[model samples]
Target: MTIAYWCVLASCLLPLLAVGYAKFLSSDSDPKNYDNNNPRDYLAKLKGDGQRALWAEKNTLEAMPLFFAAVIIAHNTGADQATLDALAISFIGFRLLYIYLYISDKATLRSLSWFAGLACCVAMFIISA
Candidate 1:
């Protein structure tokens, strides 16, 4: 499989990382605080960085479909493989940075990272055209 395809896989899994951090590692390690029986409820109660991580997971999930389609469209349209891979990697990088910025409460940087990731997605479509 191409690097772009691997990136698609990565994008699909990226939200899991955010959710894992939000649910398990963000803070409040007391096991009783976690409501496995009602995970959504537990997540809904998260605050500060935990809440930010959950939001990051949600936003990442929201972005995945378009990025997936963009990569596939670029690949099938005979866009340059190397360039496609680069953009895919860039998207991942920007998203990782976005997650970090979100968790760190750096709203401005997070927004910039989000825009950069979106730009990468748009570039994929442009390359396909």
Candidate 2:
């Protein structure tokens, strides 16, 4: 697989990994440990630090489609490998950094990384267009 393909795969997996990590940290080893009594109960349990991690995970997952679309569109438009690789790498790196900073409750750093990832997507979109 090409570097771009690997970047896309890594980008997609980052959020799922974060969510798994968060669940592991919060819940006991038992898979059935989550309380299903109240809907908010589960979400509330993920508050503060856990909540941030959850949000970051959610955001990363949400961004996956747009990232894939941008890359695919770029490929279809005959975008150079270098440009695609650069954008893909930037998107993956920023997304990973964003998740890390968010899980650690580093607001400014997380936001910066999020913006950088978004900017890479925008750059790819523009080039593809």
Clashes of each: 0, 0
Which residue pairs overlap in candidate 1's backbone? none
Give a tens-digit lDDT track for model 2, residues 7-109: 8888878987777656656433223665557534565566666677778888998999989988888888987879888989989989989888987889998
**What is the alpha-carbon RMSD of candidate 2 to the true structure?**
3.1
Over the stretch 1-129, how does candidate 1's per-residue lDDT look in tens digits?
999999999998899989888888887434557888889988888888889999999999999999999999998999999999999999999999999999899999999999999999999999999
Task: Candidate 2: list runs displaced more than 4 Å.
Answer: 26-44
Q: Candidate 1 versus the native: TM-score?
A: 0.95
Instruction: Give each model's whole-structure lDDT.
Output: 0.93, 0.80
| Highest lDDT model number | 1
